[model samples]
Every structure is written in structure tokens, then in C-alpha cells.
Target: MPEAPPLATEHLTRVVDGQTLVADVSIEVRAEEVFVVFGPSGSGKSSLLRLLNRLDEPTGGTVYLDGTDYRTIDPRTLRRRVGWVPQRPTLIEGTVAENVAWGPTLRDEPVDEARLHELLDRLGLSGFADRDADRLSGGEAQRVAIARTLFNDPDVVLLDEPASSLDAAAADRVESLLADVMAAYALTAVLVTHDADRARRLGHRGVRLHDGGGVATGSLDALLSG
Candidate 1:
């Protein structure tokens, strides 16, 4: 039998403002694989990603990371293990290097300069270490956000519409960078996106979210072309 996935959700449900965002959704995400959540606007994709990282608590059910119930774990520690990149990139008021190093610094881990450089290079941001983050373009800022998340050495990365704001070329660059990162780090990734093509390119398995708390999981093409 195949090994169990690193992340699993069992009968997960979320209700906000008396609205049922997600209902009894179950998912298994294996290590070294990219799993994508695709849906139309307000279909609970972002809410689902938030649940995975504990950013948003589920109204009912459980999330397991590496076989441990996430509710039993500390949220901060869980966040450290599961990185998140939001839809809008928000950079601190500092140099690019500082922002990239913030997570490790907070954890009291000595910053690994070589790894930092490699991540920047991989994201096509080589030599941007000294640039002020506030001055970066939208796509560049997004890349820096991704670098910052990677700096934590998280085993799982959750990205919500990472490429939505970028131009075509920049979006493609982000996609390629994510693929490289997954291979290099052997990381499990779950991304929320509306772009079917992007999901097909990034994920082997796809989950589609719809109204009435319906979820269908299968091949990327099946979800996209449904």
C-alpha cells in the first residue's frame, strides 16, 4: 500500500456569518505532490486553505498534519511548518533581504544566507537582496513573499491565487518557480486558483468547490473541463 499523505482533512466544515462555506469535505495531500483547489468566486477555496494552516478554524471536523491532529498542535508552530502566501502580497517596510529573513529571525534560527540567495535566484530575483521591498513591482513583491515563506523551510506551502495579479509572463514565471521549488524541496503544496490551465500544469490531483457545499475531487482535467 502507498504511504499516507502528509496532510489530511476529514469531514471538514466551515460556517461563517451563518453561511455554510464548506461542508464535510475530505482531502488527502501527499508529500512531494501539488494538490490544487479550484473554484469560482466565493466557492471556499481560500477558506479551505486557511483551514489547512489554522488561519481559519473549522466549525467541525479535523485536520491532520503528518498524522497529528492539528487542533492538538500550537497554531504558531503549525504555521511555521505550513507556510502561507496570500492573494495580495504584503511586504514589510524594509529591505528585501530583511523581509525574506523575518521568519527565521522570529524563530531564532540563524539565517542561512546561501539558501536565501538560492531561493531568490530560483524566483528570478537574484541580486535583489538589497532592494527596498516597498519599491518592488506587484509580481516582484509576490516573488519576495514566496521567498519569505520558503525561508521558514516549511514542509507544506499554501498559496491562494498566487499568480492572479501578475501579467502573463510574470504568472508563468511564478508557476515555473513553484514547480522548481516543489521538486527541490520535496514539498507538499496546495494552491487555490481560478485558472484551470494553471491547475492542470501544477497539480496531479484537483478539488473543485461549488455552491451548496459540494466538492468533487479527481484529475485536474476532469475538474477543469467539467
Candidate 2:
């Protein structure tokens, strides 16, 4: 039998004040696969990513991680296993290594230097351990942010348009970096994006979040044609 997917959602809904940002949306993300969430602006793509990560509470429905209800787990523990990379990453005042080691070190877990080098090399940031994070380009900063999140050793990564703010060259770099990172870690990822082409290119499956309580999900081809 096939292994159960790493993540799935059932009728997830989120409402802020009187506004319902995300309607009932459901999806199943296979283990080590990239699941893309595509939508036009104001379609709640960001909202859905937040709900999946439990960064924002849902008004209704449930989230499952490895067939276990996520709500049953403590929020902090859940977050460590499910890291988030935002549209605009925030870099602390420190060297790249310091930012990457912050999480595990904070948790009192010894940072793995070899593994750190491996990840930095993979992200094209090798020998940049001592580089000031504040001076990195948009793409470089995002890569550092991703490497930092990886220090937490998350099984699933949530990306809310990590490449959206970058220029074409930088965006391509970030996109390639994401693909490499996922492959290296065999991670399951949910990426929210306004670029349908990106969704088709990187996602194993894709979903389009409509304005109301409607969602259209299917293979990448279907998403591109919609």
C-alpha cells in the first residue's frame, strides 16, 4: 500500500472579523511532493497557507499531519515541524550562520556544523557563514531564511510566495533553491503563488482558491489551463 500523505486538510475555513478570507478548502498533499496553491489577488492563498501551518486559527474544519490531527498537538511543537517562509522574510542582525543556527540553538539542540555546510552549499551560500545577513540581496536573504527554517528540521515547509518580491533573476534563483531544498530533504511543501506557470512547473498538484466558498484542485495541467 502507498504511504499516507504527509498533510491533508478537511473543510478548512477562516474568517477575520466579518470577512471570510478563506472558505471551505480541502486538499491532500503527498509526502515529499510540492502542492501549489494558486489564485489571483485577494483569493485567500496566503490565508490558506497560514491555516495549514496553524499560524492562524480556522473557523471550521481540521488539519492533519501524518494522519494525526494537528489541533491535538501543541502549537509550538507543531510549528517546529512545519516551518513557514513568508513573502518578505525578516533577517535578524547577524551573520548567515547565526540566523540559521538560531532556532536549534534556542531549543538547546547542538547545531550540526556539517549539515549546516551542506545546506549552505546547496543554496549557493557556501563559505557565507560569516556574511552579514543584513547585506544580502532579496534572493540571498530569502535563501538564508529557508536555511534557518531547515535548522528546525521541519518535515513540511510552507511558503507564502517566497519569490514574489524578488526581481526576475533573484526570483528564479529562489525558485531553483526551493526545488533543490525540497529534493534534498524529501520534504512536503505547500506553496502559495499568483504565478500559474510557477505552480505548474514546481507543483505535483495544484489548487486554485476562488473568491467565495469554492476551490478547484487537480493536476498541474488543470491549474494552468484554468
Candidate 3:
């Protein structure tokens, strides 16, 4: 039998207050590749991502990580393996280093100072370790958020409109940085975005959501064109 894909969902659905946020969405993510979920605003892209890591319970169906059902794993453990980065960066009241090291710290694991610096360097924040997290610019804070997620060594990363709030140039930089880090770490990613060009640039295969359902699925180019 063929090895199962790194991440997948089967007939997943989520409804809130009798309103469906995601409906019967299913997709497979190949290892080390970027699988995109793209759609117009309020199309349930973010909702779908949240279910993958069980940030919200699915109303129906399930997600699989490495062929095993994700629901079987502990929520905290699942989150550690499947890191999430939201659209806007939310940093605690501390220095950049503190934020990046927060994950391992929670697990009572010793923070690897060297690894923290390496992640900062990779995210182009090499000398900002001691800087206050709250004081960074929008783009800078977002990069710090990405670094924080990577420091956990997750097998898969979920990014919800990661650059949506940035200026055009800053958005471009963040996207480029994302590609580099994913490649360098062999990380599988699921990115939610409304930008067709960004999808084409970053996604290998993707699905487009429309009103909480998957309207199209295939290679990024075909999905966007359809």
C-alpha cells in the first residue's frame, strides 16, 4: 500500500449556532508541499484550518495526521505537532526571545537558546532577540510569530492569511520568507488566502471554498482558473 499523505481530512464539517462554517470539505496534503485553501472573505477558509488542529471541534467527519485520526491524539499534543499562525500576530508582553521560546517552555522543556537564535536568523530577525515584542512593526511582529511557531518543530503548519494585514511589499516579503522556511525545514503547510497570485506562487495543489463548501480542487493554476 502507498504511504498515507502527511495530512488529510474526510468529509469535515463545522457548524456554529445552526450556521455552517465549513461543510464536507476534504483534501490531502503531501509531505513537504504547500496545500492551499483559498476563497473570498467569509468563505470558511479559516474555519476549515481551525478544525485541522481541533481548535474547534468538527460537527462531522474527521482529520488524519500521518494516517492516524487526529482526534485520537491529545489536543495539546496535537497542537504541538500541528502549529498554527493566525492572520494577525499576537505577542505576549515580553522580548522576542521570550515569545519564541514560549512553546517549549510550556512543556517544561529547556529552551534551546541556539535553536531560538537560528530560527530568528532564518526569519531575518537575527539581532532583534532582545527587542520588545510589542514594539516591532506589523511585518516584523508577523515574522516573529512565524519564528515562534517554527521553534516548536511542528510537522505541519497552518497559516491563516498570514500576510493579509501587511502592505504590498511587506506581504511579498512574508510570503517569500514562508517559502524559504518551509523548504529549509521540510515542513508541510496549509495556507488560507484570498489572493490568487499568492496561491499560485506558493501552493502545489489547492481547493477553493465557496460559502463553506469546496467549489474547486486541483493544481493551484487550475483551481484558480476555475
> What lDDT score belongs to each candidate, Candidate 1 first?
0.88, 0.87, 0.93
Colliding residue pairs in candidate 2:
none
lDDT per residue (tens digit) for residues 1-58 in model 1: 7666789999999988999888888988878888999899988888888899888899
Worst lDDT 10-window in candidate 1: 211-220
Query: Candidate 1 — which pairs collide?
Result: none
Q: Estimate, for each residue in 1-226, the C-alpha lDDT of model 2 and write its tens digit.
A: 7666788888999888889988988889988888988888998888889888788999999899888999999998999988999999898888999999989877888889999989999998999999999889889999999898887889789989999999999999889877887887898888888897788767898788887354688788877686
Candidates ranked by TM-score: 3, 2, 1
Q: Model 3, residue 16: displacement in angstroms?
A: 2.1
Off by over 4 Å in 3: none
The 10-residue segment with the lowest total lDDT in model 3: 178-187
lDDT of 3 by residue, 36-56 (tens): 999999999999999999999
Candidate achieving the largest TM-score: 3
Each model's Cα RMSD: 1.5, 1.4, 1.0
Candidate 2 has what TM-score?
0.96
TM-score of each: 0.95, 0.96, 0.97
Which residue pairs collide, candidate 3?
none
